[model samples]
Target: MRVRTDSHGGHGWERETGGPPGRAPSAARAWARAAHPVPVLVVTGLTVCLAVSMGHSPGSAALVALAVFAGQLSVGWLNDLVDAARDARAGRLAKPVAQGRLAPASVAGMVLGSALLATGLTALCGRRAALAHLLALVSAWVYDLGVKATAWSVLPYLVSFGLLPGVVTFALPGSPAPPPWLVVSGALLGCAAHFVNTLPDLADDARVGVRGLPHRLGAAGSRVAAALALLGSALALAGAARLGGALGLLALAAAALTTVAGLLWLGSGRGGVRLAFPTVLLVAALEMGLLLTAGLPSGAAG
Candidate 1:
């Protein structure tokens, strides 16, 4: 993902440099600029994986990506809007709107429009996909509204990831059913992401009273959580693949090994965001690859 610089840097810096207090509108504008597009990237990536795994046509995949992006855009906007105060307090220089670069009302309007578009596009995927997206949307809203501040922050990430595979499955033209293992893998991926993603901001979050799962657990706890979640996901995938057919066990094993390698790297104190985020992204891409290659003729060996 590209770095989204918060627009508040200039004005915020000026204020902190002994200028007058910044206006709320400046903060909101900055927040909007910073928080936008995050959903598009994450949602689009997941949709692409689904399209590949389900063997959807390019056009169909693009449409699904659009819908997913819209949904996530709505979710991301609300997240920043609701957390503006907290972000401001936390000295989150990365949030443009929160730092006073855009208006909250304008951002809300954008979110509403995007949500409407998402709802319409979801219908094209059929009722199943729409329902799944609805559930995920609600979960995301809950997470942003106040859930992230509680012990349940991790729950949203897990649910979001789990729903992603389902979204891909249902968005296909035919009745494509995602394997139970795939869903489990998505959940595990989400859990790992939750832990690793929070590592960089744990200190800032704690200072701002955002005691999320990572903040509560601390760095060590977060690492342990990432390890357990990834391992569990691998076990589930392996078991499911073995049961589905003995041929894919090797693929599952490879995924497990890759996950273990990543965990080892993360365990090393030297690992940073550049290492962790890319590692997780690669692992996710590999899982999606395994799902796509499940029925293809291959010579992959454990």
Candidate 2:
């Protein structure tokens, strides 16, 4: 029996004899994998935490969580669907669509469904909040559609993440804007995440002709860029806390330690390279924690 493999890595029936291919993964399982659950959960959980910290009622926080979760799911599914061919070519079997376990059409349908759900949910929050949330979702979709392969790839991350705080703050009674420091810190962290996230996939990306900013920077350069961005985010958060105070000092010290640890790991050769992404995530979490602790200042909230 001669087997044929499609571009999506699906084994086609034999050319000589009509026979069934191997069983595909169940739709539910494939859809779950295609949704990129970890990042979706992390982003949604973080948004909910931000809403709660900003004094949102439990119901408001739950709404924020649901909207953000649906939005993230759409983003994740769209990304997989858009990159299905590239991922398959690069042997990225971890992606359900690339492995042929999930159909691109199914992913596209989920993307539309989740995006509409997110939009409707955000609208219930208020006009300003809905606008901010919708813009963020659009920015992420732009990245997935084409910007991820361009030099301006990080632009979407900056725009999306920077607007994230507003998605919560604007849902407040007055629809107040988030503090400038919070927006700046979020943008910096998002930039760092973009660089760090691209590190592991640099090779595969290059193979598929994706030459984003991180890909052009190369591995070591991307690591340095990520470190610098993290430091900048830390400083932004510290400023928001008013650097002369104890809280500010604590934030600075923690930031310094995290940056140093990440740098050391980067310099530790191949064995420690695996720690890079986790280290960046740790710094991001630290920045978010500091932002939560600082809360919304009276003047800033107004």
Candidate 3:
């Protein structure tokens, strides 16, 4: 069989089978990879910590963590499911969904189950919190459903992330809505995430017709904008004494280096160096976790 051309126009023999020749992924591995386990685990840890910091009991924190994990799982799978066709066209065999290593039926089943569990857990928080969370999930779904190709792509991120602080706080036994600062700051970071998250895929994304905000910005522009937004968020949190000095400095330095690395990679089109994008985004997510924890008003927790 002739190997398809991958994104780089290389003969995609290594990618043609979703693994090296004669080494197809097992069902479990396929599901795991398709769901993007790393980010889900990181977010789960952060959610647990943020829940505890907000004065929730340990049990509540764990429940919150589980809920968030399931939701993230659902979203991750949904993203792959929605993008499978495009990814296949781009010869992105690293993705289990597009490479057919995982059956779409299995992923669809996982999505339904995970989404239901997420909804049930959110409902446990409160009616209002559940409502907000559903809207947030809906926004994510909207992004996956083709809005990501349009100028309106960032809107979903804005809506979902802006509502996150409210979702967290309102889940408190009797807490009121989150303050506007938290919402606005979160929206900014979320917007930044849209930029940074798309950088590694910019070339392929454009080829596959995904012209989101980052695509419009191009790689270098996206990197710089992402860094600025991340740094701005750090500054916003720090100015209010929300971010402690150590985390703030760490975040700032990481964001700066991440942008620089991306710019270099964009200029050179190197392979190994492209790994910087996801690594830096992981660091930025930690910063986001700190911000989430900081925005919570302690008095509100029951």
RMSD of each: 7.0, 4.7, 5.9
User: In model 3, which regions exceed 4 Å deviation?
Assistant: 1-25, 241-297, 300-302
Clashes of 2: 0
Candidate 1 lDDT over 222-271, as tens digits, reads: 87788778778767766654345445556656665765566556554645
Cα lDDT, all candidates: 0.70, 0.78, 0.70
Provide TM-scores for the models: 0.79, 0.86, 0.79
Which number leads on lDDT? 2
> Which candidate tops TM-score?
2
Superposed by TM-score, candidate 2 places the C-alpha of residue 90 at a distance from the truth, in angstroms, of: 0.8
TM-score of 1: 0.79
lDDT of 1 at 26: 54
Candidate 1: global Cα-lDDT? 0.70
Segments in model 2 whose C-alpha atoms lie over 4 Å from true places: 1-27, 241-252, 264-268, 297-300
Encode model 2's per-residue lDDT on 47-101: one tens digit a residue.
Answer: 9767866788889889988999999999999998888888878887677777665
After superposition, the stretches of candidate 1 with alpha carbons farther than 4 Å from their true spots are 1-33, 36-39, 173-176, 242-274, 295-302
State how far residue 260 of model 2 sits from its true place (Å): 4.8
